[model samples]
Target: MSDRDPSVSDEEWAAFVEAARKDGVGSGSVPEPRRRGFRRRPVRHEPEGWRTGPAWREMNGRGRARRQVKGVVGITLAAGLLLLALRPDLITDRLPEGFGGPGETAPLAAETARPTAPPSSEVFPDHPTLKEPFKGSPALGWANGAAGIEVPRAKAVGGMSSEEVAHALDSVKRFLVAANLDKATLRGERPTGAIKLLDPLQKDVRAYIHRSLDEPDENNDPLGLFSRFDPAEVRLAGDVVKARGRMTFEAGERSGEVQVHVDYTFVYPLVKTRPGFDEVARTVVRRQMAFALYDPAKIMTTRGLLYVLRMDESAGNSDCARDGDGFLHPQFSEDLINAAPLPGGPEIDPYDRSKDLADLPKACGTVTRT
Candidate 1:
């Protein structure tokens, strides 16, 4: 039933609602309404006293009360939304307790962004060894310890299929927009939650998409507050070798490590945040999430980017502190810090042997080595 009928489709109307791929964004050219075969309806003039006159007051006081009630209702709705946008805790703090197995606590925001839960002593899963593309393997033609380079630049090898990169970027863009955008962006004051697909067949399908303004993520977390997401590196060779993005927001942040574990169904490189937030510091988390893509029309109805199978986490920040310039830096690896990651982003601890892993609440067995 394609409701392309002229009468219904061409009806002149406006919607004050939200619509888009993620939320709080939408884009697409709506073809101009055709005037043919449609007669213009005359505007109804207001009755006497509607504006300056007092005909309503002379006739009945109930009508005046009704108008006042409507005004209050509209103001109440708008105020609620604004309050939600600014505070956001009405979303992020209500997550279902437990992440690993039964009887686990939340992994964030207790004791001032420092995790307080004890590590689970369950048997650990065997994480697949990380591949060293720059050295170690004969394929790249280099030795691991022979190079005394301060920064080990992992060469981008050929592994990600064209489809994988496309969809992965698709997922990343969706995640970034949702994480950083807000309802204030609805009027175009800021960027909206949306992604532009490159498929030629869908050129006219529209780039902007927004809905679920009040919807929360699977963990019940709100869309993040960062104003932007600038992807610095994206890679996926033989199991998502590396995919890193950076953003600087005012808060206690995190540092992430890399992984290429093969046991999972879909293995994309990930930087995840640790389970805390204390001081205002730049943070990064390796993103290793589990996901599935489908036709936009079908997938849009469900949780969409608000839902994901799994993700990675940074080692905790027990060892992080402010440097001399008042900028956050790793207490152990200050010399190895980078600008994009700030001081709290991922890549601080490679193996996550510190209490950071133990601090993860609602522990996921402490062995979901993404």
Candidate 2:
């Protein structure tokens, strides 16, 4: 039902009718459309730079540059490490043979120096043969000829009777004295007459003796003492005697003729002191027999050129008297009858009998004795 006025005049009715007509024509008021919960979605536009295109491409270019730089740095670091790992000798300087540096050049020929003496070659060929089967023992053998002189006595210091041992010690003392006297003569110093008897009358014999004296003390012991030089047995054959003893090498190996711990002894009356002593001395001088296998031809032809100036004459004299320092003074010392080796040196017996020639493999190295 609609609410309306009950009493209406004609004019009032006409006016209301007129107003209704005007409302119908104009639709002055209409119910608002019911509001809905959902809202209109907004339109999306691309960002300013993206609209230009190639946005991803530009980003990738910068990323690629960074990766390339990283790769280059990595490679550079690896190259540096490689250089550090490889230790290269840098000096271009060339030095003479035996110079102590990587730049110093060693003689190619020297690497193969070996025994060349006929006896050494015949006894010890490049390889062993039946003829050279008997390599001398440190105790005894003829390095060059018939086996060396015999001692006739073969008792150990401990094994010998008290009297025999006493005699042996006395002999050693005498040998030392004789050796000292010989060293004096070699140095142009006054030598006891006893020294002349020890002197090698024959050139070859003297050379052999000198070689023994000149042998370097490969052992680094400051005293310059050999590791071993012990004698065991001496077998006499006429004038020649094969004195056998154990000789210990620096390497501590005991092979064919080398001994670990035994002294070799051979004694004879001094030729100068005793008339007709030449026969006894010759018989007893086992150096010939012992060195027979060594090749004399292999000695170094290259002489040291450096002049040893301001050398301590007394110190040098003492060194020669005991251990020969061949490098500094190749010439044998005249003060003592025996020879001395040089400092920073090589073997006194330069002869090469690499194998059978020396009846043993030649030993040499920065840390070894030849």
Which numbered prediction scores highest in lDDT against the true structure? Answer: 1
Judge candidate 1 against the unseen true structure and give its global Cα lDDT, from 0 to 1. 0.21
lDDT of each: 0.21, 0.20
User: Candidate 1: worst 10 consecutive residues by lDDT?
Assistant: 69-78
> For all candidates, what are the clash counts?
33, 55
- What C-alpha lDDT, on a 0 to 100 scale, does residue 131 get in candidate 1? 46
Residue 146 error, candidate 2, Å: 28
lDDT of 2: 0.20
| Candidate 1 displacement at residue 273 in angstroms | 23
What's the distance in Å from true for residue 348, model 2?
Answer: 10
lDDT of 1 by residue, 58-174 (tens): 243211110000000000000002012222332222212231222123222112122233222111111122242211110121111112011222322123333433444345445
What's the lDDT for residue 134 in model 2? 17
Estimate, for each residue in 1-370, the C-alpha lDDT of model 2 and write its tens digit.
1013224444664464456445553233321111101101111211221111111211322111100000000000000010110112211111112222232233212112223441221110111112322111111222221122123332333222334333433333343233322333323323333223322312322343344344533221111111111011111113222232222111111111111121232321111222332211111111111100001122111111110000001111012222223211111112224422222322221122232312221221010100
